[model samples]
Target chain A: MTVSLEQARIIIAQTFKKGSELGLKPLSVVVLDAGGHVQAFEREDGAAPGRFAIAHGKAYGAVMLGMAGRAQMARAEAQAYFMSAVNGAFGGAVVPVPGGILLRDDQDAVIGAVGITGDTSDNDVLAGLAGIAAAGLKAEA
Target chain B: MTVSLEQARIIIAQTFKKGSELGLKPLSVVVLDAGGHVQAFEREDGAAPGRFAIAHGKAYGAVMLGMAGRAQMARAEAQAYFMSAVNGAFGGAVVPVPGGILLRDDQDAVIGAVGITGDTSDNDVLAGLAGIAAAGLKAEA
Candidate 1:
């Protein structure tokens, strides 16, 4: 099933809330449907202007490639040209970072993805996981 | 001055509310800072997958060009090549359409823009106007 608008909003809101609670920098979050289309997005007050696009690219890469962000990063390092070609094909939407997480349904099928920015990649991933858990969804990180 | 994150959220929320009240199709709304960076965006549950990009392009074009959607459309018709060049320059973030509006402060300085899509252009403009009014901001349409 596709992610509803309410679920996307919850994912964004909770992501920011988690970031705040953890004392991370202001965060930018994006939620993308399985088709790699944006469902919802927000950038906190002090986040840099480019954070939104970076978050979007990370989530788009995860949803479109059916891989977790960590895997994408590993592959990018092992096959730089391949990663570049993929990013070019997708109009540069693949960030290949650690902050993108796939959301799974009860059946273990990918339903959507969330990407977070404005902190270290590891910290970003933590916030994403917290948001996914709060939304009652499983995260494939 | 730039549009704050809270103001951007309010604009998107109220835009969707107005669309719902008018019985319009599920809409995609985007808010952009004056620098043409995304502040917030959302696509309603039933909105088309591409609606988010369309809404973003509309708002980006408005903020980048410092013009209302009507003015952009008129210019696009009068100078198609120029419009194409501008879109190319912005990496295709400029959409000449009726749903884009420039948000102005009390002194008539542009602070941001809002864009809506998924309904007829006229109805989209109406919803955007209503949202801007509700947000207590002036719309340069």
Candidate 2:
């Protein structure tokens, strides 16, 4: 499954709208293509200074490592030292957090990822799923 | 003058569209606010590696110094040692080239800057100007 940049923009917008309407905190959202490169990102006016980097990092880690960020957090618990070294090697481009979600197609193949920030971990995850749905893209199991 | 992330994204998209219409090389465009922080950025498919850095660097320099990149190049010519040392100090975050342009408001206040890459310096400047116009913003004189 491949994701185009236009779809990525739509996903980000939808994520913002849904998150805002739900009374979630201002957010920064990032969408990456299958290759783990940024397609589009948006940070709301009141989003924190580091929100963009965190949001993009989460999506980058999910797409590059082929696992959702929350799953990576679980692994990070057991291999904290190794994960830290690896993250250092990559200049800190990964975030092991619940906001990262893999986007999929009908065939169940991963196509891209979305990362949302500025809300609780659970709410961020919900925002990612909502964005994917708004874009009409499936989510990986 | 202030540049919203929405306007920044629009400017980037317009830059790509105009560059394509002109049959230029693959391009990357970046927009930075008055504080020289990345607001929105995009790298077209097939854009060369480092294109994003160059684009962002150009805009960062423009916003940080409140001058168009061409003016910065003129300064560079007269102060090569100073330019080199400054760039070295900042790890090359400043690109003194023609592609960076300052965005202004009705009062002629500097609000943001846009940097364009992947073509001749002159064409890059033209693309930046067009993008600013497309976003309904005036270019700083």
The most accurate candidate by TM-score is 1
Which stretches in model 1 have alpha-carbon errors above 4 Å?
Answer: none
Q: Report model 1's chain A TM-score.
A: 0.97
lDDT of 2 by residue, A1-141 (tens): 467767877788888888877899988887777777766667777666568778888887888888898888888898898768868977888888788889988888888888888999889888778888988998741
Model 1 quality (TM-score): 0.97
Chain B TM-score (each prediction, in order): 0.96, 0.93
Provide the DockQ value for model 2. 0.42
DockQ-based class of model 1:
high
Displacement of the residue B110 alpha carbon in candidate 2, Å = 2.5
Off by over 4 Å in 2: A105-110
lDDT of 1 by residue, A36-137 (tens): 899999999878989888998889899999998999999999999998999999988789989989999999899899989999999999999988888899
For residues B12-111, write the lDDT of model 2, one tens digit per residue: 8888888988999988888777777767777776666467678878888888888888888988999999878878877789998889889988888899
| Chain B TM, cand. 1 | 0.96
RMSD of 1: 1.2
